[model samples]
Target: MSLNFNKAEFTRSAAARSGFLRDGRPQFAFAGRSNVGKSSVINRLLGRKNLAYVGASPGKTTQINYFLVDQQAYLVDLPGYGYAKVSKAEKDRWGRLMESYFQDEGGLITTGVLIVDIRHKPTADDVTMHNWFRESGCPEIVVANKLDKLKRSQVEPALELIRQTLELREEDRLVPFSAEKGAGKEELIRLLCEACGQ
Candidate 1:
């Protein structure tokens, strides 16, 4: 079964001391550096423009946004990290917020979808997050976003570097996705469903 993108609902933030309201339902997190199109991917998955706020600003999403799908799973949009121009103090706050979320008792992150720009390989921050996910022992699916902007031949080496840096296993899948063109959406959906145990 596919993840039914029913509606984008605002859930209570655990960092705000609201606590996790739902339990047992699996959650899939979308994480990446600032301006990596986290919001755009969510919009593309749900086929709704402005659903997740496609902003030009680097740190557009400050808080954790949760979208419940079919009341069986959650699509979590985390605030982008490693954005320039943000103060060190602010970054510290984000770090703490993320620490709390990832370590939460109810935060069963079955899959981590790491987005990366196809042209620019994985940044230092990207590698750090990739390592964190592995250390956290969560299944990860890294997607090379914005494939439409890159040359066809340039895609493989870029993805290969990410695979090597992340030490991805042979079974792990890396998809080159273009949210604008709706490419790789079906494969992503199938992966998500399998990850979420749906």
Candidate 2:
């Protein structure tokens, strides 16, 4: 499968303060903790650097940003789950925002791409979100990002652990991707297209 993507446009906040209600199109989201290269991965997916705005620090992205890609689907960059720098109130606000996005705005979510650092295993928040996706009936792809940071043989064991933690089925694909080196980019794009029914 080939995906020809145009430029990506960013939104400061979701429509209705609800993470984009109105359902622009079938959408896929890149979700992970802050500083996990979620923005960089999205940028690489569309073959652009500044498309998703990688922050120099965690909690820099305080809002749910939506990027329209190729006029067919929206690539959502959700606020990172765990950021230590932010205050409790700010974190609570983001929690509310994410709750709205996940519960109320699921109609637009065709597939959710959960990213985790290859050097580290999945966190409690990551496992919780993965389980929520499974229970919510949303198609999901668990991405092991930053594979270049690890030895090749180390990838599968980490992948297996995440699959086990998430209770992923045998058919589910755990892709080891690296936005820095462009590894696994094509496979991710293919999965995105399949999720979008392209």
What C-alpha lDDT values do all the predictions have? 0.78, 0.78
Mind giving the per-residue lDDT tens digits that candidate 2 earns over 1-198?
234665567645663353374555877877898878888888888898787877888756677787777666778888887864988988888888777777763355778889888778688888887876676578899888898898878877887877777778987878999999999999988888887774
Candidate 1: deviation at residue 174, Å? Answer: 1.1
TM-scores of the candidates are: 0.90, 0.91
Q: Which residue segments of model 2 deviate by more than 4 Å? A: 15-19
Root mean square deviation (Cα) for candidate 2: 2.1
Show model 1 residue runs off by greater than 4 Å.
6-17
Q: After superposition, how far is residue 99 of candidate 1 from its true place, in Å?
A: 1.0
Compute the lDDT of residue 189 as modeled in candidate 1: 84
Compose the digit string of candidate 1's lDDT tens values, residues 1-198.
457774556564444425544577777788877888878888888778877877778887777777777667788887788774678887787787777777766656778888888778688888888877776778888988898887889888988887887778998778899888878888888898888763
Q: Model 2 — TM-score against the truth?
A: 0.91
